[model samples]
Target: MNKRMVLILKHLLAVDDPVQSEHLAKLIQVTSRTIRSDIKELGEFLSKHGASIEPVRSRGYELKITNDRSFRTLLEQLFLSNEPHDPHSPDYRKLYLIRRLLLADNYVKLEDLADELYISKSTIQNDFKEVKLMLQTYGIAVDKRPNYGVRLSGDEVRMRFCMSEFIMNHSEKKQDEGLTSGSRIIHSEEMTLIRGVILEQIQNYGVMLSDVAFSNLTIHIAIACKRIREGNQVAMLSEDVKNFRDAEEFQAAQHIVGLIEKELQLTFPENEVAYIAMHLSGNKWFSGIEGQQAQDIGPERLLERRIYELGKEMLTEIDHDLNLNISLDSELLIGICLHLKPALNRVKYGMNIRNPMLDHIKTNYPLAFQAGVIGAKLLESKLNVNIPEAEMGYLAIHIGAAMERQHLNTRAKRCIVVCTSGVGSARLLHYKLKSKFGNRLEVAGTTEYYKLPHVPLHNIDFVVSTVPIPEKLSVPVVVVQTLLGGGDMDHIENLLAGERKYIFNYIREDLVFLRQNFRTKEEVISFLGKKMHASMLIRSSEGFIGLVLERENAAPTAYGNLVAIPHPIIPQSRCTVWAICTLKQPIDWAGKPVQFICLLSIDKNGDEPPSIMYKHLIEIVDHPEIVQQLLKCETYEEFARIILKHNLY
Candidate 1:
C-alpha cells in the first residue's frame, strides 16, 4: 500500500465509528474529493486483501475486516516490504536510521541515507539531530569521519543496549505484520538455540518472565551475540558488578554465556557475563512460588533493604511532589521495591527493555507516567545512572498498576439519569449507562426532571438528562440525546475518567488574568507569583518562582495545546487554590508553546484527595478549545462562563 492508503487506514483504525470524508480530508490535509476517491480505491484494495470500507450516506466510511488472518498478512506485507517509509514522520525516520545504522558494518554516508529514503541530504541531516539525542541517552554517539560517513560508537554494553532497543522495536513492527525481521541479525537455528538456552537457564534458576519479557531477553542476547562476534565487548566497572559476581543469578548468567560461547565459537569478556547476570538480577521477572518461599525462609538481605529504601525515597518524592498520598500503600511499596531490583541493574549497565505498552501507558495514564519520571529520576540519582524513556515506561506500568490498586477504594461518582418522558425511558437510560460505564459510573437510579428536587444532591455526583434541566442545580448536569448515542457515551466516559472534578472550587475570580501581554513563561509565572505574594498567600515572589522552576525541572507542566499548569514542586500554601494568567499569544514554555498558565497550589494539610485538586486541571490541560476560550476571556465572568459550559465541576 502507498503512503496515502496507509494514512487512511491509520485514521480508520483509530475509531469504530464511521468517520466523515470531510473530517478525514481535514486530518489528511487533502480535498474532500481526493479523500472520497482515495477511500474508493482503498476499499477495492482492502476487498482484495481482507477488509473493506463500508460507506454510509451521511456518516462517510467505516472499515470492516472480513478475515483477520488475511488482513494481518496484508498489513504485514504492506508494512514490512522493502519500501520507502514515511520520512515526514519523526518516529519512522529515527527508527529507520537506528535499524540501518546498527545493521551497517561500514560508515553510512548522508547521501546514501538521503537517496535511500528519497529525501534531501539536508532533511536526512536534520533527522540525525534527533538520532544523536536518542543515541546520547543510551551512551551511544555518532562518529563522523569529516568526509567519509557517520557510524555509531559507544561502550559495547551500551551499543548492544541501543541495538536491542532498535532491533526489538523493528521486530515488534514486523511481528505485527505476521513476519520476522531478524534473520540478518541472527540465524533462525542459532536464535532458537540461544532462546532455548536462556529459557532453560531461567527455568532452572526458577525465574518467571512474561512472554514479552522473555522475547526481550532473547532479542538482547541475539544482538549481543552479533555485536560480540564483531569483536565488541560490553564493559562494566568491577565495583558496580560486584553483587552479580557471587550470586546464583551470576552462575546462571555464566552457564548461559558459556553455552552460547560454545555454540557460537566466540569468547566473551567476564564483564559481559556479569552484564548478563545483571539482566537476571535486575529484571523485574517474578521468581515463581519456590523463589518466594526461599526468600521468605530467610530474613531480608542488606541489598533488599537498600532497594526498599530507595523505592521508599522515590515514592516519598512522588508524594511530596504530586501529593498522591500513595507512599504508604504496602502493595505499591512492595511493587516498586520488587521492580527496582532489576531496574537498578538496567540503569547501571545501560540496558534497555522494550516496553511495548509505553505509548499506550503515556497516553492513557499521563499522571502516572510523570510520577514514573520522578521515580526514575530518584533512581538515577541514587544509582548514578541515566533512566531511559523505555525504562521510565516500565516504571510507569508499576506505578500505574499501583495507582489503579489505590483507586479500587475510590467511590465511583454517583450519578442519576433524568428521563422525564416516562418510567420506561428513565429505566432504559439507567440500564444503558450502567452497561456502558460499568464500574466507572454508579447509576444512583433514574429521576424524573419534575422530581429532581426530591433527589439528594448531597449524595449525587451529576445528573445526565434526556431533556434539558433549565434550573442550575447543586451538582453538574450533562444533557444528552434520549437514545444515549456514541457521542453521548464518549462525553459521559470523559467525565467518568476525570471523576467530574470540581474545577470551580480551586479557581478564584481575583486571580484570573486574561489576555495579558506576557511573552514568556517566566513573565507569566512572575505575574502569578506577584499576585500570590500581594495577597500574602506566599512569603516571596522569588521563592515562589524558584519553586515553580523546580517543579518544571521535575517535569514540564506544559501538556501541549498552548496550556500549562505550573505549580510549586511541593505544596507551599495553607489552602487549595489556583491563579490563572493568559498570554496575548502563545509563548515558548520549555520546548512547547503555552498561551494559558494555571498556577496550582494546594494546602499540604488539606483532606482533599489528590485527584480532586489536579485532575480537573489535567482536563483543562488536555482541552485546547477550553484553553482557547479561557484565553479569550477578558474578565473572570467570561472565564467562569467557559468552565460552567464545560460542566467539569
Candidate 2:
C-alpha cells in the first residue's frame, strides 16, 4: 500500500471529529514534530489550489465543500481514480491516503484510519502537504480554522480545474519521470476555467475516464493554448500525437504553433519561448519515449476539413441572411469557445459536451436562440433531410460545440462467464457472475465450456473460468477455484480497470430502437414503430403461442423469490404491439415470482418478419422468473436490473 494512502486511511479511520496533533501522532504511531510538518504541507497545498484545508490548534483537519455542481463532481471523480504505485515511489503513500480519505465519507475517524493504515500521525500530517500542493497547481485554495478543522474554498470552476490538473499531472509523475508537458504561455487562471468546464461536463453525464485519456486531454488543451497564442489560426501540422512512440509526434506538438504561423497569417514575438521549447520537448509526450512509427493522421487537418464543410454549407444556405464568413485554424479564440460550450450547456441544457472544444467554422458565431433556429433550418434544408427541426437545433449545438470542445470517449468493461457444464452450477454461476459485476460491467453471456469454443460472445472483452477448458479461449481469462466471494469482485475490478482504456465512440448510434427514447423501454419501442415506420407483428392462428392456466384457481404468479412474470400468449392478429408493462404494484405470477409482465407479439403473414424477434423473446420467456422482475422495472435505464438480476439478456 502507498504511504500516503495509508496515512489518509489512518486519519479517516482514527480521527473521528477533531483532535490535537499530539493525540493524532500517538494514534498514528508518529512523533509530534513529524505531524506538524505534515500539517504544514497540507495547508500549503490547500492554499495554492484555492481550496482550504483548515487545522484546529487543539483539533485536527476538516474538509469544507460548497455548491456549483461542476466542482463538486470533479472532486468526486478525482477521489475515485486509484492508480497502482511502487511502495518506494515518492508521495505514493499520500496518493493512496487521498483515495481512502475522500471515499471514507465521514464514516471512520482519524484514529481508526491510523490503525488501519499502520502509519504515524506525523506521517499522515505530512501527506496533507502533498495534497495541498497538488490542489494549488489547479488554483484551489485551502484554509485552516483555529479549532474547527480544514476546509476547501474556491468557486466551482477553480476547484474543478485544480482537481483535474492535480489528478492528471501529479498522479503519473511518480512513475513516468521527465514526461511532463512543462509550463506554457496560457495563463493559469484561464486554464483553471477551461479545466473546470471540461471536468464538469464529463462528470455530469456519468462518463468514466481513464488516466491515459485524462493525460491526453491535458496535453491537447496545452497545445491548443500554444497555437492560440502564436496567432488565432487553425493549425495543420505533420506530426502525430497518438501512439507517442515517434519523436516526430513530440516535435509536431512542440512546434505546432510555429508550423502554422505562416498559414495562420500571424506575427510572433520573442520571449514567447514556451512555444519553441514545446517543439523541443516533443520527446516527452507522455509516459516514455518510443521509436515506433507514428500515425500519419493530423488532428489539425481533419478539424480544418470538418470546419470548411460546415462553413461552406452554412454560407451557401444563409449567405444571404447572416452573411457569415469563417476560416479554420487551430488557435486560442477557438479553444476558449470550446471551453465555453460545457459552461453554456450547464447554463442552457443542464449538461455539458464531453469534447473539450468543437471544430470551428464561421468566425463570429452567435449564441442566441435565433442563431439556433437559423442553423436548424440550414441543416434541415441541406444535410440529413429526414431529421426534425428541433433535432437539427440540438445537433447544431452539439456540432458547433463539438467543433470547439475537447471530447473523450467513455467505455464500459464487459466480461463473459464460462460454465463447465449446462446442467448443474451454470445457472448458479450465471447469477453469481452478474452479482459479481453489478453495473460497472457488461455480462455478455454464460455458456458451457463445451459450447464456449463456438459461442461468439459479442463484446466479450475478457473471460473468467472455474474449470480448465479443453480448447484455447480467444479473450483474456482469469482462472479461479470458485466463483463466489471476495475473489470475484477483485477479478472484476481488475478487468474493468484494463477495459477502461477502450471507449465506445458511437455508443447510441448502433442501436436502432433505443436511440430515440433513452429513458424508457416502452418509449423506445413505441418510437421505433411510430417514428421509424416499423410495425409490430402478432400471430393470428389458434394454435399460436398463448398463456395457459393449469388449475381452475390460477396460483399466484409470484414465483416466491420476489419474482413474477405475467403474459398472455394469444394468437397474433395484424402486426400489433406487445405491451411490456411494469406494474407500480407487485403482482403474483406463479408461487415464486415477483411482479413483471412481458407480452410477446408474433406477426401474422406479412413482409415484416417475427423470426428475428423470436430469438430475443425466447431469451426473455425462458426466464419467466426473470421477466417478473422486469414488471417492476419503470425505465430503460433499469434494463440493466432485469438483464443482470434476472440473467435474461
| Number of the predicted model whose TM-score against the real structure is largest | 1
Estimate the lDDT of model 2.
0.40
Each prediction's TM-score versus the true structure:
0.70, 0.22
In order, the Cα lDDT scores of the candidates are: 0.75, 0.40
Per candidate, the number of residue pairs that clash is 2, 121
Alpha-carbon lDDT of model 1 = 0.75
Task: Identify the leading candidate in terms of lDDT.
Answer: 1
Q: Give the TM-score of candidate 1.
A: 0.70
lDDT per residue as tens, model 2, 207-250 = 33455444444444544445445443322222322322243333
